[model samples]
Target: KRILYIMIALCLTSFVANYSMSSGAIASEKKDGEKVKKTTAKDPICGMEVQKDKSTKVEHNGKNYYFCSERCEETFKKEPSKYERKTKKGNEISDLSKE
Candidate 1:
């Protein structure tokens, strides 16, 4: 009887440990994917709205540039003069630049 009880306790402990480990991994993955969808901005160069995961970002001239596509980023890089206008305040700019 004591041996049976010990085996049952071990089985229960292993099951609990496995359950917690899998759940923790699933929760973290959900969090990671969720972080990308929270907020989005419009790409000034291409005039398209971009989500966090979907946007290509570049840091230049003490600012972060968000682009709707890689083509837009290339365009901005090739002729930065065309897109030098700053529309947001410094604090707002900083907030959008965060990862």
Candidate 2:
């Protein structure tokens, strides 16, 4: 039926559009060609996803940490160790900026 064919075409178009958008979001990288996926990070101060390039950022202790707001940034600046990312394994993500 023509209606069935139209629905199929629409579905395919939607699939293609979504695929491209998802792929494009992950196509970003750092200056050293390290691929950083546009995924969620727990904002040090608020536990929100700090999206790639879309979230507000502050460079601290030689690594770039993302924040949900200026208030969170100020909070982290005052006591960075308290706000630093900690792994579930009881380790901290190394901030190599000091090197």
Off by over 4 Å in 2: 1-36, 88-99
lDDT of 1 by residue, 5-79 (tens): 554454345444444444233222446357323344545564444554445787766766777555566767888
Whose TM-score is greatest here? 2
Q: Which candidate has the highest lDDT of all?
A: 2
Which stretches in model 1 have alpha-carbon errors above 4 Å? 1-38, 86-99
Give all TM-scores, in the order shown.
Answer: 0.45, 0.48
- Least well predicted 10-residue stretch by lDDT in candidate 2: 90-99
1-99: candidate 2 lDDT, tens digit per residue: 975455445434533544445434533456467775445344565554444344456787677776555555677789988766566786667531211
Task: Give the clashing residue pairs of candidate 1, or none.
Answer: none
Q: How far in Å is the alpha carbon of 35 misplaced in model 1?
A: 15
